[model samples]
Target chain A: MARQQRGIRTRRTILEAAGAVFDEHGYAATTIAMVLERAEVTKGALYFHFPSKESLARAVLAERPPLETVPVRPCKLQEMVDVTFVLACRLLDDPLLKGGVRLAVDQCAPQSVDHAGLFRRWADHLTWLLRQAREQGELLPSVDPRETVEMLVGSLAGIQLMSRALTERADLAHRVAVMWSHVLPSIAVPGLLPRIDAASDRGSRVTEDLG
Target chain B: MARQQRGIRTRRTILEAAGAVFDEHGYAATTIAMVLERAEVTKGALYFHFPSKESLARAVLAERPPLETVPVRPCKLQEMVDVTFVLACRLLDDPLLKGGVRLAVDQCAPQSVDHAGLFRRWADHLTWLLRQAREQGELLPSVDPRETVEMLVGSLAGIQLMSRALTERADLAHRVAVMWSHVLPSIAVPGLLPRIDAASDRGSRVTEDLG
Candidate 1:
């Protein structure tokens, strides 16, 4: 069991190092040697966990930092907002999430990995939360959960991309808050609108609470 | 004059070929040789026009499709929607615009070129129209023109990107329409809301009228 734990730690170290390199240099420019150097691990040790750069990228892409860090609230709409806020916060500070998003959006990423899958999974998660919101009468009767999920996912992607390009993502949480402020009024029922918080600092607060 | 015109035509041809290649293969995978082959121009001719692949990518990035295809309407809000609709339509069919977007989003594009400039330009244009909308009392007094422009550009980019990744851009116009439907209700005053037409076919109509 101790040996297994050590292996797990070593694998995680390599993944984090690889993600950092990929985030800074992008997929095309990244090399396994860079990962090994960053990880400060022997080539054989790195190869044991990730055989190739593609696999390392795939591993990085697969690593989704937990969104459940935020405690669940009675209002699913607020919970959904919390998820995005927390994600924005993590994306700003976490190399793994940053690298994953960069790789997922990168057109030069390995062809075998389905970058769209990440977006689809996010949509699915949001769809489930939205359905919960609908059942609780938090959402407007006119709202279609699927379409809203797509818009949320897509718009968030765009907001993050723009923030990254323009501000190096320093203002991602603010941009996301602004996005939700515009979108939520159209989707949420009037009764629930006032109750949900879409503040820019919501992400940092959640992270603070988690810490 | 004739010699200058031929030079202009040759440069245009090289740019088109380069744009198509960039759109299909992305920045890292593309090569001058592939562009030469696609354009069926001699290496010397291609080199004379665009000295390097970076220059070719830059030339492609510099090409902006005219968004003035839609006639300016009495309602600046409607005109803004028309701009997006027309762009959505153009992005669906125009390789140059598509490639430009791809390259601009591409992190690997030459660092010297400003990728955010495109978004900034769009925001600037939208800000001007939004200012007009504000002056004409088309927008709610609470609406911030700059924030609105950033959201519009970012969300449209997200919508288009989602459409491209998921549906290969088949539903971009519809997605744009949906985005506007959600966004316009929040920014436009109650009186002006009914005047704005956010329809999937609005793009094609604008294109036909322009033609």
Candidate 2:
């Protein structure tokens, strides 16, 4: 059991290292030698864990920590929206995840449907959440849930891309939350506006106090 | 005078050739030698027209076709919008320009500010049009012009990105016109919806019959 545990740890280490390398050097430029060098593992050991570079890259791109490992739990629509907001904020804060995002946005070829498919996954995730929002009476009946999700994700991605250009991390999260507050209400149910508005007021006050 | 005219023609040839090479090979991967070979011009001739690779690239990105070349006059805001719509359709149809767009998007790097600046130029162009729309009383009085412009541009670009993923042509202008029919009513002057609805109907017919 101890030997098995050590083997798993080594495998995880190699995967993370490969992710970083690919994100930096791109898939075409990254090499197995670089991965082995970063992981401080022999070629044989690396081969023992992964058969090929393509498989390794797929692992990195597809890596997801199980929900049970995180504090996240299934919840109501409003709660899911709140959780999604927090998760998006957390994703912006995570160092390892940032490279993957940059790779997807700036490096991935639009001509490659496989790469585009990877992006559609994020849209799919947002679609699922939007459907929940609709079911919970949190959204307007006239709203096309798919388009709302698209606008939300696409606008946030655009905002993050712009923020990354600004080269300043100061107050990014607060600004993003405020932006979300303004955007969220567009599709949200009219009756819930007061609750969302009050929450947004508090957010703005916090922003002012932070300044 | 004759020699000067010849110089202008040579410069245009070099720029066109350079744009093609850059679109095919991308920025980092493309070499001066490759550009020279493709243009059938010597290094001296290439340098005479453009001093450096960076300057050449900036020219390729910054190239704007003559406004007079477009079909519609831009004197009135409505005419300006019509002209802009026509140009947007033409841009997606042009093979060479589409290639340049591919090059521009694919060349984007997280560390690079140039690509962001390019998108800023796009936003700036759209903002200018929206300001014209406001002056003409086409926009709602309560709308924050900048935010409206951002959403319109963001949504159009997002749609184009998705469309390009699915199809060969980047024909987003008509779809945007359709979207604007619904979206403009939300943010346009009360009486403006009929005009927009007509435009939307026209665009849909164009897509159905032509596309």
Candidate 3:
């Protein structure tokens, strides 16, 4: 039992170090030597733990605990969108996720092995959340929950990347949420959209310059 | 005059070669030596043309010709959307823009230069188109043209990245146009929406899977 716990700790340390190095230097520029230096682990120990550099990166990319395990409230679709945006902000706000987000964006090449799986998983998570909203009758029946999820997730990630590059603002998560709410009504079932119409109207004037 | 034209030709060759190298190897991985090799120019010619590696990269990144220099007609809001999407497809489809688009997405820590200028120009172009649409009473008076433009450009770019990463289909341009037509109505002036309502309704079911 003790041996297993030690192995887990060592693996976590290497993954964290890899995320930082990859974020700073990009995937191609990052080297195994840098990983060893950052983790402060000996060469033998690093290899014993992660067989290769790619393996180490895959671990870093997949390190987050499953979203299913994350505590979620049974909020309606609009509230869920609001909450999900908040959580996305909270995740990016974390120093750990910042490096990973940077690394993911940096390595998102067509040829890179990382792009397909990471984006698909992200889409899947969004779809799952939207599916829940649909079952609760929050999303419009005319809207396909899966497709809506894709657009929402894809737009949010793109905006996040652009905002981070442009502003270096840590408050990007909040900004993303604000932008998202405006388009949210269009996807909600017609009757439900009016429920939040008052709140949306108040802030509609504030984001006139976002482009 | 002949010598100046020759110099211009050489510069074009180098710039095109640099874009190709950056596309294949990404920004960090690409080097001037590779650009020189691809352009088949001597080191002296390369240096004389571009003072440094970063300078060459800046040239490659700078000044994409405007996709739409003039409207074909008066540019109705729906036609503007269609024309602009067609232009986007052509740019993204081109070998030159393909790599640039990848760079735009994967580039994490931009050089502390005026890189935001690129996106700013894109936003400007989109905003101009939307303003024309609004003047024609196609878009809602309540719509903030700037934010709407950002969402449109950002969403299209995001969708392209996702499509490139997942499907490898060269037809993403066509796909996005179909998708955007659905999104257009949601932001159009309330009564103007029904103008395209019939067309959008037909598409709603067609694009259900991937919209």
Strongest candidate by TM-score = 1
Poorest 10 consecutive residues of model 2 chain A by lDDT?
A65-74
Candidate 3 structure lDDT: 0.62
lDDT of 2 by residue, A160-186 (tens): 445555443344354355445445545
Q: Estimate, for each residue in B57-159, the C-alpha lDDT of model 3 and write its tens digit.
A: 6676564834454234453565556444544544544545555565565563247424455566677877877888878877755678877777666666667
| lDDT of model 2, residue A34 | 90
Across residues B11-127, which tens digit of lDDT does each residue of candidate 1 receive? 888888888888877888899999999988899999998888888887887776566557988889989989998888888778788888888777777677666677777889899
All candidates: DockQ: 0.74, 0.27, 0.38
> For candidate 3, lDDT tens digit of each residue in A81-160?
54344445444435345555555555433343374465567668767777887887877656776766666666666676
| Candidate 1 lDDT over residue span A1-211, tens digit each | 9999999999999999988898887888889989989999889889999988889988988886566567888999998999999999888768888888888777788677676767777788789889999999898877899988887788888889899888889998889988987888999989878889999999889879888
lDDT of 1: 0.85
For each model in turn, which proportion of the native inter-chain contacts is also found?
0.65, 0.13, 0.31
Q: Which stretches of candidate 3 lie over 4 Å from their true place?
A: A69-76, A79-83, A108-112, A169-171, A194-211, B70-76, B108-113, B178-182, B194-211
Best by DockQ: 1
For each candidate in turn, the interface RMSD (Å) is: 1.2, 4.5, 2.8
Report the lDDT of model 3 for residue A167: 63
